[model samples]
Target: MNSSVPYLLAILGEGVVPPSTMVCHGDDLGLLRGDGVFDATRIVTTEDGTSRIDHLEEHLSRFARSIAGIDGPTPDMDSWHRLIEDAARNWRVPGEATLKLVYTNGREVVPGPPRGFLIIAPLSETHMEEREGINVLCLSRGVTSDAFADAPWLLGGVKTLSYAVNVAALRYAKSQGADDVIFTSTEGYLLEGPTSGLVVKANDALWTTPTGTTGILSSITVNTVFEAADDNGVKTATRLMRRDEVLRAQGAWLLSSIRGVVPILSIDGHPAPHDDEMTHRLRVWAGFEE
Candidate 1:
């Protein structure tokens, strides 16, 4: 382990410990069945050691909702706040990092209480690289835009840890020499990226896929971007968009919490139109500079 690498890991009741140490049991349902929920936010540290966590309250609220969606008890927000603060204080690295809150249903057989933890680690350079630009592969999510309308069991808006499929999609995209993936619905509507929200610029307005009926997770970053755009006198809307429309858009981006905003350079090997000026404006609006 590199001693120079700073990290903080805190179990709900256990305080902080070395990140490399073993924490969970083999029978934990989060491990055995991929039953868990998580939320991540960018944590920025100044040269003076002061740190600020982006959208902390919003992420916590969403995290609690995700837990409930997975049949887990609503977590105590106060306790989570304390744990996060403790970990943040211990993480002395002076740069950008990610703070991830994770929760899982307890052991599968001898279940008692859900397990919760916080990991504060440095942000990935790859994420930073992608912010400049990326090529995406359009893949089928095998569901229609309205699939989540009445399907509570599908856990549409939930940010569950069951991300095997999402990860696989990204892996497949990489296998095809692409940097990311934009999942399209079976009905052929542009949905979202595996770990980010799809945002398009067309007709001088910002557009994104609808959340409630499209089974896409509500993206805090996208909402923040839209709010900033609104303040800057830009129009925003939510609508069902097709691949052809996205391909012909004035600009496209994949927006997420940690990565902020990343422009799409191409889709399925075809050059997608982009506006550098708009992308720069989005970065400014998203506070990506800080």
Candidate 2:
């Protein structure tokens, strides 16, 4: 690893440490069974060395909800806050970065408590490129729109560590010459992106998939964007949408914390409508614009 690239790691109870020097047991369920939850938000450091974490409280709330969804004991928010602060202060990078909070059930067979940690790393060029615009492939997620209604085992809405499927979907998109993926339900209802929330504009109104029954992870970025949009007098709604509806909408976007808002230029090799003015508005609303 290059020393010039800033990085920081902090364990739940432990203070910040060299990221490469930290170790986890081989049997930890977080690795062994992909049993864990995480949340990521942006961290920005100004020229004068002042750092601010975007939506920290909201991300922490969602992280706790994910832990509870997985039956893990409630975390000590105060300790997590201190650890995050320590890691951010140690980072010292004066640019855009991602701060992720991770928690996992402890060792598979060992009797122990849950494990938690925070990682702070600089944002990559790809994140910026994607935010400019992206072509996406619509992929079936192999579940009905209402799959999560009564299925606690599904772990829907929880940002779990088991992301093999999502990663595979993105890989599949890349294999198809696309930049990202929009996961649709088996019933053909638009769900969300591999790591983002799907939002579309139709009839001058902004629409996104509903979270509860669709198993869509509640997006902090989307929520923030909508709040800003509301303040700007833009109408917003949440509902199930078909692929065709999205394809024919005035515009489409993938909302995420790290990437902010990324416009979808094409879907399934078909040209989708683009609204430059709305895109700029969304960028400004999401704080992507200075």
> C-alpha displacement of 26 in model 2, angstroms?
0.8
Model 1: which ten-residue window has the lowest total lDDT? 281-290
Q: Which ten residues in a row have the lowest lDDT in candidate 2?
A: 17-26
Model 2 pairs in collision: none
Provide backbone clash counts, one per model: 0, 0
| lDDT (tens digit, per residue) of candidate 2 on 117-199 | 88888898888788889999999999999999988899989999999999999999999899999998998988999899988
Model 2 deviation from the true structure expressed as Cα RMSD, one decimal place:
1.2
CA lDDT of 27 in candidate 2? 86
lDDT, each prediction? 0.91, 0.90
Q: Which stretches of candidate 2 lie over 4 Å from their true place?
A: none
Model 1 per-residue lDDT tens digits across residues 1-290: 67777778899988898788776888888888889999999999988788999999999999999999999986888899999998888877888999999999999888678999989889888897888899999999999899999898999999988999999999999999999999999988989999999999999999999999789999999998899999989999999998899888899999998988899999999899899988888887778863
